[model samples]
Target: MTDLKHLFFSLGLEQLDLSEKEKNIINAFIEQSTPRFNDICHQRQDKEPLALLLGYMTQQHHIASSRWIEQQTAYHQMQSVFQSSVGTEHASKFINQDVDEYILITLLWLLVQGANKIDYSYANEQAETLLAHIHEETKESNDSKEDEQLRQRLMQAFYQGKKTTQQSLFTKLKRMFRLTQQQ
Candidate 1:
């Protein structure tokens, strides 16, 4: 029974600081969701049936919010892993905590969307994007004052609109996946 934290780190990945409680929660969620994801994948094959699968997930009304919250919790765990490792080395390099959080959140967003659609390719693309973002952000000395202000403003807007933020993010994601609202 490899724990979730070690599961991510076992492949030479940075370790996230996930508490025992969080491990239990995420592990349980993954365990519970695995069968359904497999079933959905089998049913859909590779067809781009946008609304049906998304609809299926949305229909799980009671647990929908739980899934998103769990996704967020897993993201925090991911951040903790990076923060515990490279965070100090890059702290003084102009990268702020909010930027780190944003990166992690975006990674999580891509991962969740891919998983929901049963598309590992999409997830891998997101991983590449995340790596690129990290490479760009960590070049601390190269960050101009303008970049810093933009980052700060972005973070501020994200935090200020906590409610619609998620909605807007989903909207953007829907577009990325070519999913229509009517669908």
Candidate 2:
């Protein structure tokens, strides 16, 4: 089982305390989304973008399914927690944004087209946005350099599978040509 705390930390909610109901909602979201996420990863063999996709999906599902009054309560509480943990300036980046709408659009796209058809570039952009927020909140001396390195690594990983497949194809073609010449 995936560790919820690790997932929350990746999502920039590490310091926040979730209510029992919120936890249950998150678990349900994970349960439902995991298969889709797995399928995408299996097809692409590129897991970077899809890493945060699950978290955004869970957040959207939770907000959309909750009653309005409950959502309001949870939103305010989350805002306060974020402000206190990361300071108001950084908190604003997470709380007062159209990110949720963007996430919803991505989710809608996924639902309509299915995970196997996901646009990796668009998904990577969303994942980078989420990581940027976390970088902003946790910035420190030399952290920008480290974060850039991390981003580069993620991008490399995203393309690595394709590179390997291309190399394999080239190798197979070379062997086949050599065999034809021998025959």
Winning model by lDDT: 2
The TM-scores of all predictions, comma-separated, are 0.27, 0.34
Cα lDDT tens digits, model 2, 25-69, are: 545656666676666556765565434454455455445434332
lDDT of 2: 0.48
Cα lDDT for residue 35, model 2?
72
Pairs of residues at least 3 apart in sequence or in different chains that clash in candidate 1? 15-81, 16-81
lDDT of each: 0.43, 0.48
Least lDDT summed over 10 consecutive residues: which range in candidate 1? Answer: 7-16
> Residue 83, candidate 2: how far off, in angstroms?
8.1
Tens digits of lDDT, candidate 1, 89-129:
56344323343434434422332343344354544444444
Evaluated at residue 115, the lDDT of candidate 2 is: 28
